[model samples]
Target: MKIGNVNINGKVALAPMAGVADRAFRELCVRFGAAYVVSEMVSSKGISYASEKTISLLTLSECEKPCAIQIFGNDPPVMAQAARFAVSQNPDIIDINMGCPAPKVNKSGGGAVLMREPKLCGEIVRAIKDAVDIPVTVKIRKGWDDNNINAVLIAKICEDNGADAITIHGRTREQMYRGTADLNIIKEVKNSISIPVIGNGDIKSPEDAKNMICKTGCDMVMVGRAALGNPFIFNEINEYLSYKKKLSAPTIEEKVDIMKQHVNSICKNKGERFGITQARRHIIMYVKGLSNAAKLRDEACKLESLEDFSKFCDNILNSI
Candidate 1:
């Protein structure tokens, strides 16, 4: 699949999760066969002010090329400026975030709040597209609420305004990841727009990815929460989509090893202290189904060092 002129090697893409889709995780997923990945959300205001921490979010490795940098802001001029800055960084694509349901973002007229103001949303896209040579896309929710499901409407608005593609997460702000995503909304968006539509929400496995494609006629399927501890979903879904074959889930040994690699990779990139905090979050999820997982998760979250995590992993590997 291609977003504009950018050629994605496969249909599976890792969604731009705010805190979880960092450079370390993206590189890991790309290595595991994800065709595309989006950076975690960067703030337009932060970039306009040259915030060092925010600028760091723009960092992309050579291994994660073809990755999109997603930015969030409601102001057209500020967003345009941020888009220009992001383009200068040379990411594969520049994606605008209109889907974040966070209270702070919405209160600022960004994120899901933009869903209520479709005209402003179109204006933002037009501004970004004009500012950059790369493909510009928008990530949006179904609508503001159950009563105003305007995904089909906004999809056209974006396409008409120069967006190369649109990613639709089929839930309203009110739903907030609570209800099952209405695939029908995704189907409607695909039917309404000529540009490519990527379906997102509740895709937990290869079968779900296939079902989303078959049911919605979307060009791609994006995985968000489902990918936190399981980057292998990309390889599994890609193989299934291409060959109609189901790969076995990673073994317990493989899980611990991958978790270790993830821990080490992040620690190498982001010093020990912060990396271990992030690792604890990721490792707990990676061991979600194992024996004594709850106890281990509680214990893991409190451990403060890389050596402690390595010892924890060793114990798990030795036991199982």
Candidate 2:
């Protein structure tokens, strides 16, 4: 699929998950065959102030090429400026985050809150498009709530204002991450827009990816939480979509090995202390259904060093 001049090589893309889809995980997903990956949402206001931590979030690597840097804010000028700065990161695309359901984000008049003001959404899109030369995309939800189902309207507004592509998560902001995503809404948005539409929400397996495309007629599917500790899902989805082949799930030993690799990369990038702390949740996801998962997860929370993590992995291996 082509989002403007950017060529997305696969049908499955990694979602821009805050605090989870970090550089290490995105590079891992790329290795596993993700067509494209988006960075965690950066604050436009933070970027305007040149916040070091916010700027760091825009950092790009060659391994995760064909990637996008996503930014969020209600202010058009700030968002445009953020897009201009994001270009310096050398990302292949710049994405606007209109789908975040977090209360903090909404309270700040960003994220899903912008859905209530479609005109502002258009303004923000136009502003960023004018500020940057690369393709610009927007990630949005079905709407703010059931009473306000206007994804088609918002999508058209975005397209009319110069968005290159639209990613529609099939749930309303009111629904947050709970409940099933309404695929019908995704289909409706796709039918209403001339730009490529990417579908997201509740895609947990290769079959789910196939079903999303078949039902919604979407250009691609974006995997979010389902990909936690499961980068192999991209490879699985690609194999199933391309060859109709079903690969078996990774074994306990294989999961441990992959998890260690993921952790090692995280440590290498962020330094061991902070990386290991951040990796605790990822470690829990990797061992979710394994035997002694409870004990392993308990130990994972206390992990303070690579040596502690090594011991935890040993226990995980010994359990099976």
lDDT by candidate, in order shown? 0.91, 0.94
Q: Kindly list the per-residue Cα lDDT of model 1 for residues 55-148, writing each as its tens digit.
A: 8899888999789999999999999999999987889899999999999988877898898888998999999999999999999999989898
Model 1 TM-score is 0.98
Candidate 2: minimum summed lDDT over ten consecutive residues — where?
311-320
Residue 258, candidate 2: Cα error in Å is: 1.1
lDDT of 1 at 312: 91
| Pairs in steric clash, model 2 | none
**Candidate 2's error at 80, in angstroms?**
0.5
Q: Relative to the unseen true structure, what is the C-alpha lDDT of residue 44 in candidate 1, on a scale of 0 to 100?
A: 96
